[model samples]
Target: TQLLEQSPQFLSIQEGENLTVYCNSSSVFSSLQWYRQEPGEGPVLLVTVVTGGEVKKLKRLTFQFGDARKDSSLHITAAQPGDTGLYLCAGYTGANSKLTFGKGITLSVRP
Candidate 1:
């Protein structure tokens, strides 16, 4: 079984500020994915990092997988009010593996 631990359960930041959220676990994973979700909606996948030490960028957001495949980080640059939402990290072990999600991080960006 895979378990993910996330830090900063809640974050309140002013617009244009920068922030970073982390997901970590002692178990190794085949891939890790990041997601964003808004109220009354399902989570939307932001990016998936498959290789250890791989990094992916989506606009002002950057996602990185640790070299050991046991951790990941999501950094947001110049946060905006529209970016306010819940962020989640999920890890997958294999094709038949169930995805394990961390306790979500709720971000509130103030204008």
Candidate 2:
């Protein structure tokens, strides 16, 4: 079983600041996904990177997949207090396409 691990399990930052969080694994993935979860709800898909070295931008957020497809990063620019939530990184692997996920990073953007 492949495992994806997220770094800096919790991050707290001020509004307007920029920060980047990471997800990495020793195994390769067919595709990588980023999800944002709010209180009392399931995680919502933010983006998916299928190819190596691919980058996608969503509003003030940027997502990148490492060339090896074993790592990914999520960067937020000009973060706002409203953006505080749990961000999860997941990947599809093996023939079964099992969804492997990390513990997630909780971001708090203090106003």
Candidate 3:
């Protein structure tokens, strides 16, 4: 079984601050994805990292995949109250493989 671990399960910050969250696993994944969820809504895909050492950026958010494909991280710059939400990391092995998710991190940005 594949399991993902996320660090700093909860975070609170003032608007305009920066934060980083992490996800790790012992198993290798074919692809890794990050998502953000708002209250009463399903998670929205943020970015997907496939190649090792690959990095993707969306506005103030950045995503990276580990060189060994066993970990990932998300960094947010100058966070805003609108950035408050649940962040999740999910891994995919293949088409027939079951998807595994890390214990999500909840972020609150107080204005």
Which is the leading candidate under TM-score? 2
Per-residue alpha-carbon lDDT of candidate 1 for residues 1-111, written as tens digits (9 for 90 to 100) = 438988889999999999999999998889999999999999999999999999999999999999999999999999999999999999897676788899889999999
Please give each candidate's TM-score.
Answer: 0.95, 0.96, 0.94
Rank by lDDT (best first): 2, 1, 3
Cα lDDT for residue 55, candidate 2 = 96
Of candidates 3 and 2, the better by TM-score: 2
lDDT of each: 0.94, 0.94, 0.92
Q: Model 1: residues >4 Å from true position, as ranges?
A: none
Error of 3 at 17 (Å): 0.8
- Candidate 2 stretches greater than 4 Å from native: none
Compute the lDDT for candidate 3.
0.92
TM-score of model 1 vs. true structure: 0.95
Clash list (residue pairs), candidate 1: none
By TM-score, is 1 or 3 better? 1
Q: How many residue pairs clash in each candidate at the backbone level? A: 0, 0, 0
Residues 4-27, model 3: lDDT tens digits: 898889999999999999999998
lDDT per residue for candidate 2 within 7-107, as digits (tens), equals 88999999999999999999999999999999999999999999999999999999999999999999999999989999999998877767888999999
